[model samples]
Target: MKTSLRILIVGQNGQVSQALQRRLAGMGELIVLGSSQLDLAQPDLIRAPIEALRPNLIINAAAHTAVDQAEGEPQRAFAINATAPGILAQVAVDLGAALIHYSTDYVFDGRKPEPYTEDDTPNPLSVYGRSKLAGEDAIRQAGGQHLILRTSWVYSTEGRNFLLTMQRLLQEKPQLRVVADQVGAPTWASTIADSTALLIERWQRGQPGAWGTYHLTAQGETSWFGFAQAIGESLVRQHKPCAMLEAIPSSAYPTPAPRPLNSRLDCSRLLREWGVSQPDWRSALQQCLAGQA
Candidate 1:
C-alpha cells in the first residue's frame, strides 16, 4: 500500500476482473491483461509479463470456468486453473508480492446437509473442481502471502453467468423448468471486488488477517429455482414479459458434470478474520439489476 503500489490482475473482461478493475481503479497502478496478452495455458510465457511488471500484488482472476465442458478436456482445464496458479504463486513468492486467487464451491461434493465450512474436506465432483482444488493446494505449497477465496454461484450483468442466462430465457420463453435440488448463494462479482479492495486497505494499514483460504460469498442460501424466481420477479416488476417458472428435481435436467446438492459455504471465517461481510444474495441481486438498469 505504497503511494505507487503496482497491482497485476491476470484477467480482463472476466466477471471478477472487470469488477476489480472498477473498484481498485484509484487504489494503485493496475496492469490488467486478457488471454492474448497473458495466456495461462502457456505456463512458460506467464513469467515474462509478470516479472516485467514487477507488481506489488498479483490478483489472478483468470481460469477455465466452463464446468461441463471441462469434462471433455481435463488437461486444458488443469493447465489454466491449476498449473498456472502454482506458477503465479511461485513467481509472487519470488517477487515478495502477495497473491490473491479466486476459487469455486465446486471443490465440494455438496453431500453435506449444512453449509460447508473451511474445515470441510474437498471432494470434487468434476474436472473443473479438481483443477481448482489443485490450484489452491499449489498456492498453499508455495508458502507465500496468499488469499484463496472460495465463492459460489457468481453472477454479473457483464459476464456469461446464471443471472444473464435466466433473464434472457425468462423473457423469451413462456415457461421454464428450473432445478431446485442444487443450492448455493448467488454472489455478485462486485461484492468480491469491493471486499478485496477493503482487504488491501487493511493489509496496507497494518491490520491484516491470516494468509490462507477463506469462504467469501454472499450471506444466505437458495436453490437455483429460488434464484430464478427472484430474477423473474424483478422482470415482472419492470413490466416485462416473464416466464412461468416450474420447480423440478435435478434428475429432470441432467448435464455432463454433476452438481452438488448443497453448495452453501459458511462465510463466518471470512467475517471473523477479515472483518468483511457481504450483503444478502437477494439484496446483491437487486443492486446488480439496478446497476444494469
Candidate 2:
C-alpha cells in the first residue's frame, strides 16, 4: 500500500464493482477489467493481465451470484466463485498484493436465533452459499494477506435486486405477498463501497492484521414484508403509488433455492476493527430511492 496505490477491480459491470469504482475515484489509480477481458472461468487468463498491471491491491467483485440458478449449475458456480477465487488468491500471493474479496450471508444455515458472527461455523443451505464458502476457504488456504467481507441483501439504484423486483411486481399486480418470517439486513451497494474504501485506507496504514473474515451489512434487521412496506410507503410519499404489500409465510412462495429464515449478521468485529458504524437501513434505502428518482 502506497500514497496512491495501483489497484485492479475485477468485474466492471457488476453493481458492487461499479460502486467500488465510484468510491475509489481520485484516491488511487484503479484498473477495472471486465469478465470479457479476464473471465473468472479461465483462471490462466488472469495471470497475464495481473502480472502486466502489477497492482499493489486487487479487489475481486466478480461472482456467480444467481442463488437459485446455482442449484442446477453447481459446477459453473464453483468454477467462478470457488476455483477462480483460489486462482486469484494464488496470483495475489505470488505478487504480494493485498486482496479484497466479497462473500455472502447465505454461507450460514440461518437456524440460529441470534445474529451470525465471523467466527461462527458455516453450514450453507444452497449451492450458491457452498461455493462462496469454498471460495473463502481457498483464499485463506492460499496464505495471502486478504479480506473476506461477508455481506447480505445487496442492492442498488441500478441492478436486479429485491428493491427493483418489488417495484416491478408492484407495477404489474395490485397486491404483492412477501415472506414476513425471514429476517435480514438490506445493504446498499454504495455503503459497501464506502466501507471498502475505509478498509483499504486502514490496510494502507500498516495496522495489525485486519485481514480476516468479517460480516458487513446495514445496522438493523427487517423482514421481506417490512422492507416492502417501507418501500411502498416511500413510493406513496413520492406520489408514485404501487401495489399493496401483503405479509405471508415462506411456504406461501416457494423458489428453486431454499432461503434462510434468518440472515442477520453481527457487526461488532467490523466496528471494533475498522472503527466504522453502519448507517441505518432506512437511511440507506432513502439514499437508494432518491438515486432511483
Candidate 3:
C-alpha cells in the first residue's frame, strides 16, 4: 500500500522556514503554519491541525533562536524550544509520521579542538543550548521515526544573521570589530533546505529508518574574523565599498550568554548515511552574497 506523502512545514515566516518552503514547492502537498496559526510555545495548538491534516511528514523549522536572550529567559526558551517539540514528536508518533527536527552545534561545550561527532556527550553551556538538547531528548524518548540534524552558524540574506549584520555594519562604519575566537561553518539556509529535501526524498523511498542523528554543516570552518574578511572581500568583488575588519578576542566582546569557542561539527556520519557532501563555506557564501546584491 503506497501512501502519498503529505508534508507539513512548521515556522512559515522564519528564514529557514521560507527557504524550506521555496525548496519544497511543487514537491508535494505542503501545509505551512506560522507562529500565529500554530504557536509552538503552546504545543496543544498544533494538535487540531495535525489531526485535521494527518501529514506523512512533519518538518520542524520552528525554534526559539535568540541565544543571548535565552540566557535571561530560560523558561520561555524551554517552552518553545524544548517542550513544544516534544509534544509535536508525540503527535507524530501517534500518527505514524516521520519527524524531522533540527538541532544546534551549541549542544557541545566547545572544549574539543576537533569536530564534535554525534556520539560525543552533549554539554550545553547556555540556556538555548540546554533547551535544544532537551528537545532532542524528548523526540528520542518518544520512540518515533525521527531524523535529528544538528547544524551551526546558519544565515540567510533575509535574516538577522552574521552575514546581514556584517553587510549592514560595513555600509555604515568605516571599521568593525569581530570576535575571532569562535570557530564554525558559515552555513546558508538555502543549502540546508535543499539538503534536507534530498534526505526526505530518500526517507520516502525507504532508505531512512526510524531513528538517526547527523551533523549538517558546510565543508570547512573559519573564525569569526576570517568570516568577516571574506564578507569584505565579497563586497569588494560586488563593487561595493569595503570596510576595515579587525579581529579581536572573544573576551573583548562579551555577551550575556557565552558563545562556544570551538563549533567544529564532524559531518562524517552525516555524509556516510546521507551520501551527500556539504558544499564549501566560501562558495556557499559567494552565492548567498551575490543573491543579496
Candidate 4:
C-alpha cells in the first residue's frame, strides 16, 4: 500500500487473481504468477520468487479449490492450501512485506443458525475446508502484517465457478435440481477485487489495524435454488435460454465432500473497520452479466 509498492499476486488465472489483475492495475508494480512460475504445490519453489521480487505486498489468491476432489487428494490439498501459505508468510516476514490472503467460509462447519462471525470457532467439515483453515492459522501464526478476507460462493464469467457451470447446465438440460437447504451470499470476483483495492488504499494511509481476518462478500444471502432462479432470470433478460430450476435438499446431491448448509458470513467487521461495503449478490450478478454482454 505504499505510494510505489511492488505487489506480487500468487495466482495468475484463477477468478480472483484475474479480477485483481484488472483492479490493481496502475496501483503498484504488479507481478502475477501461476503454477508454472511458482507452483504452490512445491513448497521449495515458493520462497525464491518471493525473495527475488522482494515485493512490498504479497497477495495470495491461489489455493487448492476443488472441494470434492480434495476428498481423494488430501495430501495435495494440504500441500498447496496449508503448507504453501505458511512458507509464504515466513518469507513475507523475512522481507518485511505485508500479506493479503484469501480464505473461504468452508472453514466453518455450518452449524450456526445465524451468520458466522470472525470470533466464532472454526470447525471445518471437509478436507478442503480444513486445508483452508490450516492456511489461515498459518498466516496468523506467522505474526506478520496480514489480512485474511474470508468470502463465500465466489463466481465470475470467465473462471470455473458456479455461475459459469449453471449457465452451461441451464443451456444443456430442460430442468435443474439445485440444493436449497444450503445458503450463502454469491460474491462476484470483481467485487472482491475492488473491495480489496479499497482496503489496500486504506493500508496505504497507514492504518495498521486494517490487517486482520474480515468477512468480505456480497450483501444479501440466498439458497442455491434461489441463486439458480435468479441466474436463470438474469439469463432470460439477456435473451439467453435457461433451464427450469428445482429446489432440492443437500442429501439429494451427494458428493465426496459435504458442503456447509449455512455459508452466510457476517461482514459487519469489514464495514465497521474499513468502511468497505459490497453490492448485493443479485445486483453484482446483473453487473457481471452486463459486463459479459
Candidate 5:
C-alpha cells in the first residue's frame, strides 16, 4: 500500500510546514524548500524548481502572514501571497500534479453572525486578507485539482504565534490584556498537517473528488481572551508561571490592519465530505503545551 508519491512542500520553517514535514516524512519522497531556495516574493522564480521536481503533489504552505506589516507593504504582500500562488498553480497544472494551498479566515468581513461557509461571499477587510483571497481565486482559475484549506488563529509550540507569545508574556508580566471581541478557533499546526495527511491518504485510496475548498480548524470558537486563559491554565497544570488574563475589546488594542471579529468557520464540509474531525481548541491547546514541555 506504499504509494511512494513524490510530494513537494513549498515551505520549510513555517509552523504548518514544519508539522507537515514531520507528518509526511515516511509517506512520500518529501522535498521541502525554504525562502532561500524558493522565494515566494518573486513569482517568476517558482516555475523552474517545480518543473524540475515534477512532483505528484505540490503543497504551497508558504504565505505572507504579517497582517499589520502587510498594511505598510501591500506590494510585497501581494507578490508573495497572491502572485506566487498563481504561478505555482499553473506549474502544477502543466506538470499534471495535484496542489494543496492554505488560506485564512480573513477573507470574511466578520459581518455574518454565524460561521462562514464555503458558499458565503468573501468580503476581505485588510490587504493581507484580500491578497490571500486572490491567491485562492488564482489557484481555481488555473484549472488544476487543488484544495484551498482556510483556517484561523494558527499556532504551534515552535513558532512566532499567539501561544508562544502568551507563554513568554505570562512569565514576564503579572497580568495580560487580550482581545475579547475577536473570536475564532486557535488551530494547532499539527492538527492541520495530520488532517491533511488523512485526506491525502483517502485520495490515494480513490477519493479524488475531495479536491476543493474546505474550512479546517479546531471544533470550537473562543476569543483571544479565552485562548489566553486556556494557555494559562495549561501552564499552571505543568507547574509553569500563569498570568492573570483580562478581557479587552479590539478597540483597546488597535493595530495597523483590521481583524475580523468573527473568524469561526463552518467545518461541516470537511467532516461530511472527508469524514475528518478536529479536536476542540481547548483540548488542542493542552496537547500542544504538553509537547512544548
Candidate 6:
C-alpha cells in the first residue's frame, strides 16, 4: 500500500459504515461522512467533498436501505442509491482511486431454487431493489476500478437491522410470527468489514483479484423464523423471557414492498478469487450477540 494512502468512507452511523471505520483505522487516513456531512440524496454536491479529499480508496457504505418505505419514495431512493453511486464512481475515476460499494441480493426476483450467483440476471421485485440495481449499472457505466459487493441479510449489534429488532421484540412479546418461507443468511456487519479489510490488504500486497461484482455473506442459510428461534434461544440462556416464535409464510405478514422468498447468495466466487471466507450465520450471530454482553 502507498505510505500516504488516504481513505474516504461515505457514511457514518450505519452498521457497515461503523464496522468499516473500526476495521480500517490503521490502514490509512479516514474521512467518514454522515448524511449531515454528505447527504447521498444530494447528488450534485457529492463530487465537491470527494474531490477535496482526493482519497486513494473510496468506500461507499451508505444507501437508502428502507425496503418497504422506498416504495413510496422512488425519487429519493433513486437519488441516493442510483444517482449517488454513479457520481461516486465518476469521482473515483477522476481521482484515480478504487471504489468499494455495497450492493444487495434484492436485485434478484428469488424464483431460483438455488442461491443467486453474480452471473444470474437481475429482476428486482420492489422499488428498493430496482434502485440498487440501477446503482450497480451506473457504477459499471462509469468504467472505473470498482468492487460491487452484493451481500444478503446484513445485521449487527447496532443500528436498524434484523438481529437488533429480534432481540428486542423476542423479550417484549409472548408470541411472534416470523416469515418462514423467506430464507437467507443473517450476515453480521463485522464480518463484511473484516473481509473488506482483507481485500484491501491483498490489493496493497499487489496481488488483487479481478475487479467487479462478488457475493459476500455468511456460510449457512436460515429463514426469518429460524433466525428468530435462534435469538429466542439466546434470550432463554440469559434467563430472559423468550417469545414463542411461530413460523408463517410471507403472505401472512404483508408489507408495502414485496420480499424475495429466497435470498441466499452464492459466495464461492469471492472465496475462490479473493481467498476470503465467512463464518456460518449461527456462529457469526453468536459472536455479535456476545459483543452486546
* Candidate 3 residue pairs in clash (backbone atoms < 3 Å): none
Model 1 over residues 1-293: C-alpha lDDT tens digits?
Answer: 56878999999989999999999999989899899999999999999889989999999999999999999999999999999999999999999999999999999999999999989999999999999999999999998899999999999999799999999999999999999999999999999999999889998888999989999999988999999999999999999999999999999999999988999999998889989899999999999999998
All candidates: TM-score: 0.99, 0.97, 0.97, 0.98, 0.98, 0.99
Q: Which model, 1 or 2, shows the larger lDDT?
A: 1
Residue pairs whose backbone atoms clash in candidate 1: none
Model 2 is weakest, by summed lDDT over 10 consecutive residues, at 202-211
What is the C-alpha local distance difference test score of candidate 5? Answer: 0.92
Model 4 lDDT tens row, 5-74:
8999999999999999999999999999998999999998889988999998999999999999999999
lDDT winner between 1 and 5, please give it.
1
Which structure is stronger by lDDT: 1 or 6?
A: 1
lDDT of 2 by residue, 1-293 (tens): 46668989989988899899999987689899998989998766778888889888889999999999999999989989999889888899999998999999999999999999998899999999999999999999997888899999998877688888887787778888899999999999999999998888877777634778998999999998999888888878878758987899999999888988999999889889878668999999998888878
Compared with the true structure, all predictions reach lDDT values of 0.95, 0.89, 0.88, 0.93, 0.92, 0.94
Alpha carbon lDDT at 274, candidate 3: 73
Candidate 3: tens digits of C-alpha lDDT, residues 51-78: 7889988999999999999998998899
Q: CA shift at 216, candidate 1, in angstroms? A: 0.5
lDDT of 6: 0.94
Backbone clash count, each prediction separately: 0, 0, 0, 0, 0, 0
Residues 1-293 of candidate 5: C-alpha lDDT, one tens digit per residue: 35769999998899999999999988889999999999999888889988998899999999999999999999999999999999998998999898999999999999899999999999999999999999999999997789999999999988799988988998889889999999899999999999999988888888754678999999999999988888887778878878788899999999999999999999999999888889998888878877777
Q: Which pairs in model 6 have colliding backbones?
A: none
Better of 1 and 3 by TM-score: 1
> How are the candidates ranked when ordered by lDDT, highest leading?
1, 6, 4, 5, 2, 3
Q: Write the per-residue lDDT of candidate 6 for residues 96-155, one digit (tens) a residue.
A: 999999999899999999999999999999999999999999999998789999998999
The candidate with the higher TM-score, 2 or 6, is 6
Q: What are the clashing pairs of model 5?
A: none
**RMSD to the native, candidate 6?**
0.7
**Candidate 5 to native Cα RMSD, angstroms:** 1.0
Worst 10 residues of 1 by lDDT: 1-10
